[model samples]
Target: MGLNGQIPRCEHIDRCPVVEHGPPECRACLALGQSWTWLLVCLSCGWVACSDDSRGGHAKAHYQETDHPVVAALEPSSTWRWCYVHRRNV
Candidate 1:
């Protein structure tokens, strides 16, 4: 299924203000000089941030901060996405 249909009403979608600029800057990853590995879809407010700072820990932080779970690799080649809370692929 396409993302539109696969991902139901992600609450974060409206709350996410980062999408306005194409892709939000990977704040967590930029600090570490490591390119972002995944696009963390905020469950609380769909803010797409880079995974972890040094490879995608920020994504986990979002999970830690908010119970919302679900993240996808920003890589175009990747179609696999995961939900941390659900502990399953979406």
Candidate 2:
């Protein structure tokens, strides 16, 4: 629930830019020679980053830097979307 006791909807999804795909791996992790556990694709801008559970938490970092709230799991078998601001699956 949100402050108004209503479920918060993801505001970024509708305005997300359409991207065919993102990079194969986290660019930040690659530049730093670090390993990432999983990848997430930012729906707002299609930035590929590491999950928060990863060493660098690059996905969360990207959100902090860009205010892009929604991200979809970039795993082959996953079809889930998450809302960073609402802290829930969208």
Q: Give lDDT tens digits, candidate 2, residues 1-90.
A: 588797766776767787755767999999999999989998877889999999999999999999988889997789799888879887
Score each candidate by Cα lDDT: 0.60, 0.87
Looking at candidate 1, what is the lDDT of residue 39?
Answer: 64
Q: What is the lDDT of residue 66 in candidate 2?
A: 90
RMSD of each: 6.5, 3.2
lDDT of 1 by residue, 1-90 (tens): 448667454443334344322256667567778686456555445556776544567777777787666666665577666667556665
Clashing pairs in 1: 12-45, 12-46, 28-53, 29-53, 51-56, 52-56, 52-57, 52-58
Best by lDDT: 2
Residue 18, candidate 1: Cα error in Å is 14
TM-score for all models, in order of appearance: 0.51, 0.81
Q: What are the clash counts of all predictions, listed in order?
A: 8, 0
